[model samples]
Target: MRIGDYKVSYGADEAVFRTGTVRVWMIVLFLAMAVFPFWAGDYLLYMANLTGIAIVAAVGLNILTGAAGQISLGHAAFVGIGAYTSAILITKLGLPFIICLPLSGLSAALFGVIVGAPSMRMKGLYLCIATLAAQVIFEYLFKNWESLTGGIRGINVPAPTIFGFEFNNEFRFYFITVPVVIIVVTAARNLFRTRVGRAFIAIRDRDFSAQLMGINLFRYKLYAFALSSFLAGVAGCLWVNFIKIVTPEHFPLHESIRYLAMIIVGGLGSVLGSIFGAIFMTIIPEVLKSMLNIVSAFSPDAMAYLSPLQTVVFGLLIVVFLVFEPHGLAEMWRRVKDYFRLWPFEH
Candidate 1:
């Protein structure tokens, strides 16, 4: 009775996985993911954890910059705030990891609201500069506040323990990272189906029109910041606990730029794009290093010639994506799926 993938209801039309084939593939993907940690080596697991954390942060940036059209250059500051909050709570107040996790997000959300206040009056590059100022301020605080942040020596964190089990290794922590990524992706994907998420898109498209439609531009803008920073904070907390350390040097301005690039290269405003972007950004460097090692095995001085080009190559790739496929990796992926789905057809 249901033929040719046509939907009879809005719910069906708005479904994240629109077809049975897509749902089956998603199940298969999750099953493969569940099996990955069991077979993956330590280094691969470590990279997986890093990619997971990056996914969380990139998704957040996409929510603000991609979906909401608000640019920020201080996302790294919010991330640092969360890292410090979790570190202080654990080392000083003796809070458990379970308790500190949400607290880290809340703490960052507070600062996000404060920093996002300028978005009410500022737009585009002006707003970007305002966020940049925040980055400088927070970085100064993180560095100079020796009493709290340990003056660049940083703080060490113990592995997270839950229910008498310690997530003390890459293998154990993979479980934690995977679940959080799943929840974050699911929530973000569903978010755009709601009124507030629509409002964000509206504001991103045309704020004056959105305002005329009774949407409070300022309030929604702050909401975007708060939500974005909250996710970044969660990523930060996971980052500190996973690495067993927190430092001022970790969340630098360049780190913020890297995140912006993730959303851009992954396809702005797309949840699946965020994941692809994070994975590509985090893993491609390692892949390049591996290739360099292979070349170095053949020629001892290969690194001397190839090392500097890694960055150039990476930048060039981004440029290519921007010029050829401004929609990012997600669009490329969708096209591939479409090609297969319509194989042997002549239109």
Candidate 2:
């Protein structure tokens, strides 16, 4: 039977993979991911790539809203900014994907700082409305700025390449998406162990007390926004290139809400939760569609009524999770692990 937990050093306590079993499982997980695209079909690989992108974006949102307690309703607009920036860099300046990727993130981070400036004076719903305003403004710019953003026409992106090795297919793109997801998740996991990340948590818990402890709330809040937007930008760059298009319609207000839902359904302030939530949110809808198709095989008229129920079912699932388990899927997963770890014993 497993006994108690122990750590002799601070480093050991703070380690990401604290036990051998966890490390082995992580290794197995990585191996599976590495082998996934090789055996998966084209559609499955596309979904995998999309899931990786969602994980990156959800983690970013979780960092800001969940960890830092900074609410945002303009996240999708920032994503659009990143997508457009990468597209413009590649199409107008003839920059390569490698150069445009970081540049896209930097551009979004700049705007994120500008949008986040009001956080020095605002909080709660007031701040949310401000972000909503930003969303409207950016959307307007995307639609009306013909000379720059293509004015509703959108930009078509070419596949990314490294040293002339073009990632022109879903199989090749899978390599890029998976590695980026891993790097982003690892960085986010490590971030919470740092001083700045602690500062974010402090701000989230109690800004007044955080200030009493000499933490500059504004600086750290801005840092949270910058980092969050940077990751979103990276996701956007990958998304634009993967889809081979950039459009204003892709990043809407509902899209921001969807990202918010991801963190909430996954678990607030948890890195692993972000992954769970992203996968859940991204895959569940597709699963529902498949189920609907199965039902339709028996009843030709089923889709007419069932089509609208898909949204209702999704909303109901979120409600059920919220009402029964407020801590989210991540908490449920933790409970499962704890139960298995202490098998034949109950605390």
Q: Across residues 162-235, which tens digit of lDDT does each residue of candidate 2 receive?
A: 89999999999998999889999999999999999999999999999999999998999999999999988888
- Model 1 lDDT tens row, 178-225: 999999999999999899899999999999999999999999999999
What is candidate 2's TM-score against the reference?
A: 0.97
Full-model lDDT for every candidate: 0.92, 0.90
Give the clash count for each candidate. 0, 0
Off by over 4 Å in 2: 1-6, 305-307
RMSD of each: 1.7, 1.4
lDDT of 1 at 161: 84
